[model samples]
Target: MLTKTVHSSTDAYTNFTRKEWASLAYQASVSLTDEERTQLQGINETVSPDEVEEIYVPLTELLYMHTKHSVNLHNDQNRFFHRETKKVPFVIGIAGSVSVGKSTTARLIQALISRWPNHPKVDLVTTDGFLYPNHVLEERGLMKRKGFPESYDIRKLIRFLSDIKSGRKSTEAPMYSHLTYDVLKERTQHVEEPDVVIVEGINVLQVNKKDRRISPVFVSDFFDFSIYVDAEEENIIKWYVDRFKVLQNTAFQDPNSFFHRYRHLSKSEAEDVALSIWKTINGVNLEKNIRPTRHRADLILTKGEGHRVEQVEVKKS
Candidate 1:
């Protein structure tokens, strides 16, 4: 159980250490096997089964509680308004720096939430697909600032979220190919009446000032819940470089991969390239755009060394 020592004095949030948070895991209804847990981890991510049990289990239980209440509220409101009750998917947004393990967190939550008998259908989508196509980015001279807030098609992303929230069937999102470093025009992720949708990306919680006057709708406006993963910049850089080295030997080796030209480089050279990219591109975006939006998330997961979640902060109700 969380103690007074773990709680922050601030009115905005209640903070808890890992052990304090884990004590709530007993409330989690489902468990995962080693294989299932392994499958949820991202490349070079250091999450373990024990970590999943201690961290994500209780988190999913909380999401379930929120979803149940949302459904009940929707039903009561519909009856009061004399309108037909409709199923609206509970949308969860996960945001963070490029290598901060947001994807792993989203996947783990989706897996755990889907295992429940009531909400058997859960879908996960990455906002990489919402990014402008490579040619468009090149034309707009945004290729260098690829992951920044201006690089996304905010209007399209909002429309997609709008359709999902309205319970529209067969809504589709563009598919991005990391190997090709581009969007596949012919491929799309078709989402159909899911019980829950988990949207993961660095831009999910970003607020585009450019769109505020024109649209008045931010990307996170449709989110029922939001999570921000946090880690020190140095640690994230190390993880990014490590993942780059692994990709150099694996994905970069594929001739069709956008980064295939770098596959022949020595490990040191690969690490240098990764470091340069992080410092100039990803790190700049994280500092300027992503990290600033961390305060907007409903929950923040702070990671320490070895990509372990050391603490959690939940918005105080």
Candidate 2:
């Protein structure tokens, strides 16, 4: 059974400790390798193989179970309608603030879920791809709010999801390059028909709550399941600053890097700038856009120091 600390004010999710959620895996074998974990790590974001065995293995098993049930439900609905509609891909959305490690979580999900029986195909796409191109952001004077909701091309993102949910055999999803810090003008990632799709982004769960009556669908409407990766603001700030420093030593040193100017900054100067950006941009965006959607997720993974998931909370079915 899960352990929860609910007060009179809390009404929805039944919280689970890491151990309790791990038990749901029924002791499944660890199929993810160290090399795979290495591939999944983002800058300053490291996911150990042990964490995969303990945390992600069970999570993916549960998701696979959910996918099977979702397929059956889709079939049942089709039967009721007297139509032969094909089952859509099971979409798993991972949402959180910048530097909260949702991208690595999404990649691990794709890797682990693909190892399940039938070796079902899974495609992981980051919604950074859905952000408006640099020129577009510049034209709109939204360069400072690059990761905020207003910086995204929502119509394009909605159409992309609509295509997959409508069972289109193929659709193109644009790719965002961290090195260039822009959407590649000539490149696009193809979302071929797949069994599962894992989408990671800060705004994946942000829905239009005020205009729901007029809006036909929100971006999160396509998700079969959603996980919100969360941590204390202080921890996320540290991670963001640490990542910025790492980027300064690595990607920012490249002549073609969009952040090349940062590579020349002294250590203290870099730290100051990182903290300032977090305080002004990322922090404010979190309060206004990201954190508000936490309750909309099916599961919440709260992290402790050292970026470990300390607890899991699942909303009642």
Stretches of candidate 1 above 4 Å error? Answer: 1-10, 211-214
What residue runs in model 2 are displaced by over 4 Å at the alpha carbon?
1-9, 78-83, 209-216
TM-scores of the candidates in the order shown: 0.94, 0.93
Worst 10 residues of 1 by lDDT: 1-10
Q: Pick the candidate with the highest TM-score.
A: 1
Candidate 2: clashing pairs of residues: none
What are the per-residue Cα lDDT tens digits for candidate 1 across 214-246? Answer: 477888999999999998787888899999999
Q: For this target, which candidate reaches the highest lDDT against the unseen true structure?
A: 1
lDDT of 2: 0.85
Error of 1 at 211 (Å): 4.6
TM-score of 1: 0.94
